[model samples]
Target: MSVIIDFFDETNEVKEEQIEMIQGLINLTAQMEEVDEAEMSITFVTNERIQELNHQYRGKDQPTDVISFAMEDMGEGEVEIIGEESARLLGDIVISIPRTKEQAEEYGHSFARELGFLSVHGFLHLLGYDHMTEEDEKVMFKKQKEILHAYGLER
Candidate 1:
């Protein structure tokens, strides 16, 4: 599995270690979810851009820290096979850098930690994991915690 991360926006404050943390989150997801072959893109956008996306996609005019567009949700027995030349487009994850920074500060965690959390949450959404109901929230939250713990990011 490969996470085709594409950083955007003018968040030049982002450090190399943070980028590596993002990659580490991807590896943790692949290992925990048993995703053999998958490809996803992660893009960082400004608050204005993310607000537009939220309005267009979710009908929400406010800017969110992150949003996800999932591709496929295979069942347990479903087979995942991809050609060597073909990279399945799993989905796209768009995050608001300014929002994330604010959240990180508010949550008393590192910016990298917040970024990892958003990325993992977006990836899980792509896999059809949602926290709509109590049971669903329990499951999804547990999985999120596990993935974050794997990266040593606990709040």
Candidate 2:
């Protein structure tokens, strides 16, 4: 199993070290999830850009920490993405730097931990994990905690 990650710093807020850290975190998450192969994008954007995306996609005008666009959505049928070199195009994860900073402060955790949380949360969504219900939320959150702890991104 292999995971290919591409980083785009659209807001110019993400540092090189941060990218390295998040990339490792993502790779660890994918390995833990047992994904065979995947190619996904992680884009760091400004609050304004993220808010616009949230409004257009989720019908929410507020800025969110992260938003994921999965290539293989669970529709009536399904959508299989054929990425470069036969790697599956799992999805794109867009994160708001401002929101991440605020959330890290609010949660009293390291910025790296909050960033990992958001990235893992987005990645889990791409893998079809959701928290739309109480039971599902528990399952998803427990998995998140386990992944984070294993990655050494705990609070």
Worst 10 residues of 2 by lDDT: 75-84
Q: Write one digit per residue (lDDT tens) for candidate 2, span 1-155.
A: 77899899988878888888888877888889888778999999999999999999999999989999988886676765455587778989999999999999999998888988999999999999999999999999999999988978789
Model 2 residue 122 lDDT?
Answer: 94
Error of 2 at 123 (Å): 0.5
Off by over 4 Å in 1: 73-86
Candidate with best TM-score: 2
Q: How does each model score on lDDT?
A: 0.82, 0.89
lDDT of 1 by residue, 70-102 (tens): 767665798876667665567888888899899
Q: How accurate locally is residue 62 in candidate 2, as Cα lDDT from 0 to 100?
A: 91
What TM value does model 1 have?
A: 0.84
lDDT score, candidate 2: 0.89
Q: Relative to the unseen true structure, what is the C-alpha lDDT of residue 7 in candidate 2, on a scale of 0 to 100?
A: 90
